[model samples]
Target: MTSSRQQYIERYAEYAMEQMRRYGIPASITLAQGIIESADGRSPLANSANNHFGVKGTYNGNYVLADDDKPNEKFKKYDNVGQSYEDHSKVLMAQRYQQYVRKLSHDDYKGWAAGIKKGGYASDSNYVSTLVDVIEGAKLQRFDKMVIQQMNAEGKQFGVQSNPLSNNKGTKAKATGMNLPQSSYSMPVQRREFMLITSPYGQREDPINKGKTQIHHGIDIKTNKDNVLATENNGVVVGVDHRTTTGGGKTVTVEYAREDGTKTRVQYMHLSEISVKKGDTVNAGQKLGVSGNTGTRTTGEHLHFGVINVSADNKLQWVNPAAYLAEISQKGNLNIEAQHNGKNILAEYMTAGTKAVNTDEQTPENWMSKLLGSEDAALGIEGGGDKGLLGNLMQMFMTLLMLTIQMENKSKEEKMQAVSDAVINRHIDISSFVPNLKSAVLSINDKGNAVLVVNDGKKEYSHELTNAEKNSISNILQSDSDDTTKRQRIGCIVNAITFSYQASNNYEQIEAQQQSQQQTIQRR
Candidate 1:
């Protein structure tokens, strides 16, 4: 079946909203220009060159010969639709469009459109009216509303107070039977099944020095994985200490804001590697580093996790890591299994004073294949489906097409072209939906047929599966460890769909891009 105009808008709405957040461009203006300039995403230039908005001249030493007002004129080409969209945003910041940037708010689509035309973006007499018709008729202004809501929820403006952990404070500390600490709370490392708490946070015999008892301010957690994860939400990396001394070595301290707007610091120490530097923003569950015995005081590979709260009068108090993790663990959700390195690994949430063992899966790779296979069965193609490739690619074209629509202005277009030259030429693969996937669910429909629902945050797309597909998905979900949450199960199904689809349609392109990216890093 042929793609619809509405499908184009829906597919790229998230990307447009993200651009709006990053570049202060109205989502409405971005979407409107995309529709009109790309002929609802069916333009030849868009299809062959990934050049939306008919941007002219040499872009990064790459040029596509296309007929515009004259034959064989130069037009800007992009590697992906996302790059085009980003370039469009940058183009609008040029000298000619600087007035619009200064005068218009990010949400004012009308002002942007008027400013673009008055600023001589296009030679066509009806450019302004055409853009207005597209914006108004499609209710693209609603996207602007979505952008604002997302930003407000994130508390990025207006001095509005925010709490990142409001939804994550799972259970009360008393319920876990571990005496709660006076101030501050969180798990040092999440999914405790893979981690063993070797040392508790209290007075104990020093493992490093023989005999004498010492007051330990931190808990020691041992894990097989080299990487470490953040414990609290809305955290900013405040300090990084790399000294190899008596204290824990290679530490990263993150400052977190509490409900009352006060701040506390969580420290992860004894690391083999660190992923964050000072002044970098971090989120809870973000990978920070690998566990290692880096300090003179440490005996083996383990995480020395600690928390500190400061009073208004400059007093300091240490919080018990063991009790804090136990309390938070009692209220936390079950762990989800994520696919990494072709393995199905589950991050297990631990209860107070309990230890967990690995599941009975003989091999993780075999399990990953079983779960991912279900996705292929549902799509009704081979193990890797081809039925959806054409459609996916077409939609990708439309997406890229809209991204460059705002680049028609002469002065900014030239500037964008120059910048594109500085960055190496690359291409976007439109045949895979892996980048947008959030979660998916597979279940029996009213008619008893297996159906799959894929969520990309903004909307859900559903497809019916074959009988074989239903059985495969059900079996995979049921076979996972008991610690896996329902959300994790759904996530498994969604990832399986994406992995299989991309493998079948765009595997080579994906591999090439990865290789190219690696080379780019090597060059740098």
Candidate 2:
């Protein structure tokens, strides 16, 4: 006799896998979330309405009243459990969840769980942890493997289509068989041989404050006064900071626009001199400055390079510079306009590189054998005849995999150096603030308070945000408003905070003056 959990898996595994094939959601994640949400198919909602995912709203003009977070909530009432699974896939197919569905592979259930939770699929803080636990405990990853294997067998690519509700800009390219134009990439420092990296990206000992670990946002390349620092791509200079005492002295930031209308920014720091000012358009390999030890954060003469993706709303996210450069190097092009697939090329390269490193046994030969059943099947020929068309395709695939394997063999330091050489920085404009804040860093304190640090080009102000202020900022960020609307709302909040600070300071000064006057009268 099998447990109810096992019975649940046996009954619904096919539906989960089918959904994964149709959509890019991991079968493991769907099954685990289903198990948890529907209580192993024993919940009242599941029994009465056949809803396995607790998906809200009516389904085919049918819904069941259920208590979920709030009393008397209407949960979608599906005709059958399979329909529930399909509905769950459709729910996640929304534009907001496209980042996970399109980016992550079918086997990456952990990423799927974390991404969905971060996308606000659930209000529960432990939603990701719980989903991961269910996936691991039930061994649902096998279902994900099954779907991927089937997809491979059919020669079907494993990628999700764009959400129907989202913008349909790239659809024409797919239909017409014309590739979208891609931005070219290059190394920041021109060199004859592979550039020597002084410091790599990721967690490392803080050079200035020894022993303590900190995230090195960018990699440091070994250079001298003679080595010229250059822009990695065709872009316009957005920022040039010339503070030699500390913090990335003599920084030059250039922003490159991608074919998808997104922006990538690269920053070259610790330069001895800057050749371009803000608003200057420069081509790839154009000289920006000379590498130097101008910053106090550095131990020697080198260029500190960093890259970041800038969203339309001005939010910044760091990219691994080393992985990016390694990708460009592997492509054997110093400045080649590669095809854009409506996704971050650097992110895809990093993910593929990591998979190649971690699973060395997954070679092209092994993959062909597993998917095609035998060498004979892969060759698609009989009696030792000429290699067939399938065999030629297999040969091409093997050659590609061999190249990937070679790339994987590169030292970690080399990857870091490559990425560092391609690093870009984005400049955030906070000039909309009442005091015209130049920059702002919002973070939470150890005490669970929202602390905001804003610089007004002259002085920096740190303020512990109140609940209302925090909510206002959070709401503005989470809204589906345009960039201008978001920025204006944020400016209002900043203005309010600054006014409050000024009012408190003035009140304190008046009180102190009154106290001083009282003390003088008492002495008289």
TM-score for each model: 0.35, 0.34
Q: List the residue pairs that clash in candidate 2.
A: 265-424, 265-425, 266-424, 266-425, 267-424, 267-425, 306-424, 307-424, 321-419, 322-419
- List, residue by residue over 202-280, the lDDT tens digit for candidate 1: 4456776776555467777644334687765667999888777846888988876555544666788888888888998
Q: Local distance difference test, per candidate?
A: 0.55, 0.61
Off by over 4 Å in 1: 1-3, 157-524
Clashing pairs in 1: 60-421, 79-426, 79-427, 79-428, 170-331, 171-331, 191-348, 226-290, 228-289
- Cα-lDDT of candidate 2: 0.61
Instruction: Please tell me which predicted candidate would have the highest lDDT against the true structure.
Output: 2
Candidate 2 TM-score to native = 0.34
